[model samples]
Target: MHLNRALQVTAAASSLLLVSGCGLFSDSTASTAGFNPPNIKMQSELGPAEGQVNLIAWAGYVEDGSNDPKVDWVTPFEKETGCQVKAKVAASSDEMVKLMKTGAYDAVSASGDASLRLIAGGEVAPVNTDLIPNYEDVFFGLKKQSWNSVNGKMYGVPHGRGANLLMYNTKEVSPAPLSWSAVFDDASKYKGHVTAYDSPIYIADAALYLRETRPGLHIQNPYALDQQQFDAAVDLLKAQRANVGEYWSDYLKEISAFKSGDTVIGTTWQVIANLAESEGAKVKAVLPQEGATGWSDTWMLSAKAKHPNCAYKWMNWIISPKVNAEVAEYFGEAPSNIKSCDETSDPAFCDTFHATDENYWKDVAFWTTPIEQCLDGRTDVKCVPYAKWVQAWTEIKG
Candidate 1:
């Protein structure tokens, strides 16, 4: 937990970060903020398991001890609930969205980028939290967020979260950087040694920084960007791109770049910093003063779920105290269940990740799919959508 660097790794969220794959929606269908989706009625009550539940998930999420004998959590759930778990490993959110649309699966461990997509498209149903008893133990901060809910109704159960922290080579960064400015306005100081998270969502990091630095810009939420504000953030990133040596999408790539001094400073998750430091990179990761952008992947039930009862059972099982702790530690993220903190093998794990600290996440804008209707709830102006963000990202990179 050095420098309080703790996080999750190698999941759909990780791969989602590397791709510009938030599907495009036209202006007509873009404003999903408060836009009422097709009402897929949630299950009012649970019944006997359907014998099996097919799931689409990130690599490490739905384990069966096949990967690591000691890491299996799914087996016990099957034994307890009598519902067999068949999991498909997805590499990215787009693939997850595609998989969900086919109605081949009952549930998905969706990342922030895809949760809104699923909800807006009516691919997932509203969660009946009343039926899931264990959900009450989940960290209060992880509940009722923009990505996992719509129209004040919950859509999924939060899995875990990790911040996009600022990592700098201790040997190179003089005077110890504090804010995101080192990678933005002062990026020229590092020249080609600077690095950044390689995703269109990265625009939020710039917008987050601008929110603190340029108050007159009146940027309320990083994801809720109007045309002028979005352009400013893009311009800032365009300038930073010049100083950046590489935009890293993989954890190992970032570690290697930092280890070889190819990147002296840039965006990183806690686990990436730990791995890089362990590999002999003089690195330190910190949740900077301006806060950061992060992801809290959710366990969502498909709208067309064939095993509705089993899917509900799996959702409840995954976030149960012990299983939540095991998965959170295994995945390298802060457990969503507050009770899971006590069950974690590392007693200080929750502390390291700020799992229950609402103040810590106050400025940390969890990644949300930006829509035409402003997420910040501005009625007068039409905000940019994810489609435009993707297009702008491609042009900025060019």
Candidate 2:
């Protein structure tokens, strides 16, 4: 619920900023640092084995009939490796977890929330970069990320990332809102017409705000809420509930809500904004002055993966510049690969999307779901943990 509120505030404010020429800007220094070339290896220490790789991923992440036939990124890898591909589409983190339990999926494109769950559950295995020849080419920032690594053992390959931006319809709202306070503290401007993402896990967004705005309050992890932090986030959401038009999980629903003028401001992703624009809606994704929360999806290998070699092959193929660019374009997120961002067909892609811009990146306070310890900066004590966040989410939704 806190997460939903955070998103709602973000969506409403972002739409206002974009129309006022305050949209995201590219970070040249961060882009250059992110794009630095990885040390290349001539061959994979682990050779390709004969098998099929079954990947559980989001829709449109793999080949999804949207791109040119000649430019399909996965075809070359399939042809060269002789590894058959079986892709299953999953919509949410919960669905991904259920699918992984079957032991049929060899790999998955897991977001930060699900990656740790998989690693902790022993559903995924630690990656051996040496076995993946192109692993050296991956950006160092991605390689050593906290979400994909546990105690120095890496669990997955970094794919793409984006913030849960604040976006809104410019024609409907005026005097662009600058901070979350406008959306939460004073939401009367668009009462009964606002919306938020309908996911229980979004409570972390609330914790992020408290961490920045009320650090002295001594709240623990936002996801793992103590009575105090939980009350704070929930109180914030209860107030927000009055302003929401409806809680949404599907992109089509959000897009339709925005297009029909049924909803003016709400929580959204860059992909949703791109889709809305293509559908002729005057919407824009924004990064507020107070910052926003986000996630990075990683490609993780199954612990009992039957096609380890094929999985590695797929990982190597997807992270390449050309393939990374194609995926980024399709998903509407900034590519993790610096080279891939450079090779994108549209010269203005990074600038428009704010992918490689340091100014934009620094402005955002990206979301990394709180785990065992609290992320709300209460070092003096450990408050409620992520397990609690999961439980509280169920109660809040109920």
- Per-residue alpha-carbon lDDT of candidate 1 for residues 1-398, written as tens digits (9 for 90 to 100): 42222343232233223321321111111223556778899899998889999999987899999999999999999999999999999987778989999999999999887888898898999999999999886765677778888766788898989899999999999878999999999999999999988778889899999999999899998999999999999999998889989888878888999999988999998878767888899999998898899999999999999999999999999999899999988878888886776677776677778765666766678888888889888989999888898898898788
After superposition of all CA atoms, the RMSD between model 1 and the true structure is 8.4
Best by lDDT: 1
List runs of model 2 lying over 4 Å from the truth: 1-45, 64-71, 219-227, 363-367, 375-380
Evaluate model 1: give its lDDT.
0.85
Error of 1 at 317 (Å): 0.9
Per-prediction TM-score, please? Answer: 0.90, 0.82
lDDT of 2: 0.70
Best by TM-score: 1
C-alpha lDDT score of every prediction, in listed order: 0.85, 0.70
The worst-scoring run of ten residues by lDDT in candidate 2 lies at 27-36
